[model samples]
Target chain A: MPSTTATTRRALLRTGAAGALAATVPASPRAQGPARGEPLRVGVMTDLSGPFAGAGSQPLFWGAEVAIELFNERGGVDGRPVQAVTADSQSKADVAINEAERLLGQEGLEVVTGIYSSAHAVPLSGRFEQARKIMWITSAISTAVLKDRNLRYVFRPTVHSDQYGEASVSFIHEHAQSKLGTPPERVRLAAIYEDGPYGTGVAAAIEANAKARNMPLVLKEGYSASAPDLSTLVTKLRRERPDVILHTGYNPDITLFLRQAKAGGLRFKALIGHGAGYAQIDRLTEAFGNDVNYVYNVDPVGTQMLDWSKLGPGVGDLAKVFVERYQAKHRVRDLPAHASMGFNNTWIFLEHVLKPAVRKTGGMSAEALREAALAVDIPVGGTIQGYGVKFAAPGTPMSGQNERAFPVVMQFENARGRVVWPTAIASAPPVLPLPPSSPYAARS
Target chain B: MDPFLLEALVNGVLLGGVFALPVLGLNLVFGVVDVIWLCYAELVMVGMYAVWFLYTQAGWPLPLAFAACLPFVAALGVLLHVLVVRPLLRAPPINQVLATGGVLFVLQGVATLVFSTDFRSLGVEMPPMEVGEVFVSGTKLAAFLAALAGAAALWAFLKFTYVGTAIRAIARDREVMPLMGVDPRRIYLITSAVGGTLAGFAACLLVVQLDVHPFVGLSFGPITFMICVMGGLGNMLGGFLAAFLMGLIVSVGGFWWNTEMSYVVAFVFFIAVMFLRPQGLFAR
Candidate 1:
């Protein structure tokens, strides 16, 4: 009787263990379906309540949401609905890492994207790599994320920091020589940047590119990002008297610099900015009024500036639809440049890579998605932003860099920013020497 | 002197004048209360936002907005003293510091929640005044003059008024003042209000020049505190002199090297002064 009771007890324990194992196992994609098919989960980690909440992350989130909505409306990724699971990083690096881990480990998402500050992006990208998940960095432009670190699963779809440097120098050299009658050799350049990865990377790139092109880079200086006063810097710039000043800074610094420069009467032949603070047209205009006029900003092509007709067929329609829907949803007249880039990158991944990956592997896995992404080969004039999507392979010069990604030089004329470089898509000619009203304009 | 260096020096003096306005109040409070108000800068930030709302958003005259900010901020200061500081009077210095730090965080968080971290500027455009080859910003010059006038008024009040004398007496000996029939609590409340009033005036001067944001106080706060410490805690005149000295060091240093080096030079000077004269440049 005792032997029989022990055997029954062992049998009951075995049965309970089997049941637990079955319960712990995730349901197959088919079983988890809502009538049609199970949705593909994509995690979006963004700064919703921190420093960059308004300027960087909020717009990015809205942009991605709009893109996902448009994609689902058009039958998302081979009839399977695309679901976005979002978590706020609170503009802190540790918090960003936690959110990324939660989305990937707990929520079981295979793909993740979105980070505003480079400070947050660097660590979060590493976490994504460790998890072996595909991280499509949409907005953060720090070069350290890809170049300084050995990241395999990480990919950036937007223009990088160094690209801004190269573009600013190249545009000034070409445009100034052509429009302002300044000799290429006579174009003395000064670079003032906020002391951070974003500013330093751009400054270094500007120096290298200018050296390569044999252009004279006269002075380069770095200042604290949150310095209360930049009057001394402006005074120094005035004394040095460079023909063109290339600056890299964020909102407050840029506002302070421009205002102080104006107050000090520090004028240059042309003033150029690398995205960041310059892209916020509304804020810039509000702060400085006509002072922001004619300042050339090198940034990714904004949706408003993109002439879709010049791009391939249907690209124009896509651009129109995006702008219309974004306007309708956000109740804003213009879609932010970061938002457009986010939308475009996400759309490209879903269309060119995600759907194809699902068809090839018959399921959504990190490896399959990455393989599909690597196989993508979209040519120029194919994307809604008038640029193509073709990411360079890992362990290369342009490693994980979008080879076709380039910035357009937009000149702020009458408080309106219009594309003015690379002539083909430019709405207006480059205003070399700026307007007479500009602080950097050539004095009589 | 080279014209550029001369200009930098002049600019530094003007900037120093602006810096003194905020530091004076902080110095006064620290001198009397024997407790550091870590949230002093955030008080100025609140004043700035108030000015922006009243002057820019509500379409009130700039002078009226400035007037409104003073009382509003002074009230806020009294409220903070009553709620946060009063209970911690008997606590250790570290406890008081930690509590004030909590107040700082709370104020910053509230500002962020209400204002949404977006930068707002008054953009009070006043044409600049040119002196020789140097261009003096009209806003900066006005702010400087206002700071000087405000400093003179404060000096007069502290020197001549009975209440001011009582407050000064309390700073000398908080425990002994109450024995002499002066209510320390009432005097402390008045001191906080006066400090907040000074912050409001400083805010008006700053809002014209700098962008108003939740964290704008941080930009000027640490440096103002340094000035207070170097000025001999409660020594208003010493704080005033230190403000200009530090400002000159920053401007001249920045001119000679860079902004970072300028800060380094200022800090080094501060450290040296602290080592040599613990009571500060002016103890009396």
Candidate 2:
């Protein structure tokens, strides 16, 4: 073998010195094992045993787990298998903070992700920022978490609550006159939301955007998502007779609203829902059947519901892999948006951020990962979800948010979502106002 | 009254009717057994699950599913009383309350394990009916009527039936009932069974109006307790009337304010009632 005086980038890579960050060890020519003694460690913090389980955290974990498994199969990130240390948030902020500190201080992991609740995300971002570690959040809709805080190490690739309001209001703005035969100014709007961070954040955006556009927001009401009776709220809506109802709520509350609205003869031209419970199409179909068909929801497009052919090459196959792995483990084929979010966001962090960190920076340190994440600029259809990955530069307004990331308004048809907004990737045209068959359609 | 206020008032009555059944059941249990089943809402949760499972998963007719839910929960009530309350009948009140509270978690956990946290609705709803200027939900109206019928039947049972007489007599004086050829244990068991039956009835009504999940009990549990306490724990008619008062407060208050503020108003009213009439509005 020949000896070299200096170590070049190519030489360092050829010698498998890519694990130069920490825990470095001698490597074989084939690079069979991790260059470091241990694999790349990441923390998956989510609610596993509390109210946020099942729908929120469990799916988030499952999707991330599938991604970890697939990444390991793909010879791992930078030839080192990714290892995930999961801590159940238990859906409590105090517990989440404690677990996060343990993960950062005790476990000494450089990165932690997968927080389902916005409340946890908001508090934990401060923790991660102070620690100078990366918190690649997969899902947390509230804009307050990162709107203008300008934290250095936090990045969220998923849609935010503000965007939900933007998407919904803009969709109506685009269609108000074209389809409703009524101008945006003439449309009587109402806002009803669950009194949680998620619902409240989205509702605030709706009010702001509506006011900006000079829309007549006749009613804005907040209610408990777990309220046993929404009849009083239903009666209020009936009397107001708003042309458009912008609603944001969680699982049971959405069901309650729809059922009561149907029974209270609450008529409306349209009811636009912002994610959360609205994302669960199959469950809504189970409860309302065809009644859920025309109702629209604002959220990131489901990976399976996207036009995969238009996306980057191999995106379709990757989505297929995720679904297959998800079904094999969960024994159910119904994939909620949260699961896809867990998988896609984790996968994005791995491919767009982590790989580049190792390949370009020659290390996977927190600083290197942040640099790599900031450099990511996947345009529309670059990811499986049909949205791109491009984080807003650090220290800017909405810093670390994926400026390219946007939610679409989807109409549920036969328990399947069809993108109906943002004409470029939309699968179908927006259905303005509910059809006559809809129980909630305005009284003619 | 304004149309919206009239609708709110009508909705309050419907809401009251739904709250009535569980209140009566808890009252019956407390009156005869003199032991509060803190897990009363949990029992109703289990009954809701039973009806949902029998109707949706078991593919039974809706009526048959409801029919099965009553006895199944009644039997569960018997089991609960025998396994937990019976042993602690002579124990400290706090201990009994703690034990039942523990069972509340057990039921929620088991339900989560089996049914997951997904909301399972009955998928049953009827169109609203026009009443002059107001619109009323058919499902709520139906549930309200059923709750009233259930309460009337409970009243008739307490007044007429031999077992029912023994139950009321035990409520009046436990020591005398045992001395006068009545087995207190049997009457207590029967009271628990009746409580369970009422829970089952409430379950059927709730499943139609709300979604069934492990934590469904949390939605109505606090309000049920508040109403029972406001009505004088063991007083059935008092609890029945208190349910309507609370319901009206919730409904009309919501009309005056927001749903959340209305709840605050209702809770404040409950606290005021507690301070003013600790023995309850209809207490003897």
Candidate 3:
């Protein structure tokens, strides 16, 4: 009787252990309906709140929604539907890392995309690399994430600061120098930037590019991002009297500096900026009225400026679709750069890698999805800063540069930003010697 | 290097005076009441918004806007003191801090929700008056002059007035002050009002020199706290001296080193002062 009882107890223990194992294991398949598998999960992290809320996040979500719908209509990635889980990073790096961890670890998301700011992407690069998950940076421009860190899982689909800065200098050389009837030497340049990585990095690149092209950078000024006043700096700029001024600043700072410069009778022959801030066409119109006529800056990828009707395959009619959907839902005008970025970045993920991987695996695993994304060879051929997309080797100058496209220089004319450089993608002629009514000319 | 350093120091001193002027009432109230005015920064924010609303929305002149904001902010201050600070005074320091902090958040939320966080620069622009290597704009000069005058006026009011003496006494001991024939509550209300008015004066200078943002209040609050503590918590004269020193440090340090580290050094100074001389450099 004791031997029999011991044997039964051992059998019961094995049974209980087997049951627990089954409970912990994910349920495999249902026989009847669609292919026996789970939906492919893609995580999108965006700047939902904070300073870059509207400009950096809205479009990404919209683009994802559009792609998700299109992919589902064609029968989901593989036979399983595509699911997206988006979280707000609030433009913070730490929050971004935490969200990426949750999506990868808890939700078991196969692929991730869409960090808005470089600040958010820089730190999260490590988390994604450790998990061996794909991180498609849609809007962030900081190069340090891929360049300094050698993050294998990271790939950037958007233009980096260097490209933008270089483009601006090129635009100045091509448009301003000849138009002003001045040699490169006569065209002295001054650059004033905000004291963050974005501003500092861009300013350094602009200076380098200008020097490479034999353009003298007469004045270099770094001002605090949250400085209460720029009057002292503006006064100094006036005294230096550079022929051209390139400012890497946010909207408020840009407007404030111009107002102060005008008051101080400071003048520059021309002014240009990288596309990070001061790209709001409408806000500039409202603030300065016709003063925005010839003040040129590299423009953000706003769909309104793109030729949506002529877009190539996989690019879709983004400009029209964005405007229509955005207007219908938010009752707002054209989608802003932030909104445009948000939407396009999400679409790139769904079309480029998500759908293809789901088809291959009959289901999505984080590892499989990352492999599929690496194999993707599509060009980001949209009107919003057209570029070829691919990843750089984890440790290379081309690592972040691999999948990123260079931003085209665009000019702001009549309070509207239109692509004007890289003659192939050029949409319009450059605007030289900003309008007389502009604060630039008035200060001069 | 020395010439630019000297120039930068002068500039910092001038700017520091402007930064300190608005913070005086806040420091005074904190020293006397033992209540950290979490809304102290918001006081300045509100003052700025009030000026903007009066000047732009209400179609008033610059001077009118400045004048109108003082009483308006003062009233708001008294109301805030009664609603938020008064009830929480006897609570734990953490609770007092939290209650005032709540007021700060509410004010920030309301401002952003209503006005939006766009930068509203004053329309009037003035030219800078350049002297050799030293460049000072008309607005900066005006801000410096106003800050000086305001500081002097407040000093006189505190030194010569009966109410000012009562306020200082109340700050030291609120319950015992009533036995000395001072109504602690009335003094609290009046002191709160004075704090708001000084914030208003700072706001006017801010609009003249810089653009106003709904979130600008947060940027300056901790710096003011540092100044107050570094100046000797209850000593107004100490606050002035610390403000000038802070100004010199920011301007010169910014020029000589990375401009971004100006505040970092100031914060380090704060920590050093807190540890080495908790009573502050000018403590009696």
Assess each model's interface with DockQ, reporting 2 decimals per model: 0.28, 0.34, 0.17
**lDDT of candidates 1 onward, in order:** 0.80, 0.84, 0.68
CAPRI quality band, candidate 3: incorrect
Over B147-251, each residue of candidate 1 has an lDDT whose tens digit, in order, gives 999999988888899999998999889988899999999999999999999999999998988887677776898999899999888788899999999889999
TM-score of chain A of each: 0.87, 0.87, 0.82
Please give the distance, in angstroms, between residue A187's alpha carbon in candidate 3 and its true position after superposition. 3.2
Superior candidate under DockQ, 2 versus 3: 2
lDDT tens per residue, model 2, B207-240:
8888888878888988899999999999998999
Worst 10 residues of 1 chain A by lDDT: A27-36
Per-residue error for A93 in candidate 3, Å, reads 3.4
Of 2 and 3, the candidate ahead on lDDT is: 2
For each candidate, give the TM-score of chain B: 0.97, 0.98, 0.94
lDDT tens string, model 1, A1-444?
323432343334335433532332334433233212588878766665544654556677667777776776666766676777777675557777776777888888899877777777778777888889998888888887788465778888788888888888888778766776877777889999887777888899999988988888888988876788888888888788898899988767888888888788788888888876777766677777787778888888877787677888887888888888777766664556767877888888788878999989888798998888888888888887778878888777656778888888888865667888777777877767776766568786
Model 2 score (lDDT): 0.84
Chain B TM-score of candidate number 3:
0.94
User: Interface Cα RMSD per model, in Å?
Assistant: 12.8, 12.8, 13.6
Most lDDT-accurate candidate: 2
Model 2 per-residue lDDT tens digits across residues A173-206 = 8899989999899998899999878888999999
Model 1: how far is A407 from its true place, Å? Answer: 0.6
Better of 1 and 3 by DockQ: 1
Q: How do these models rank on lDDT, best leading?
A: 2, 1, 3
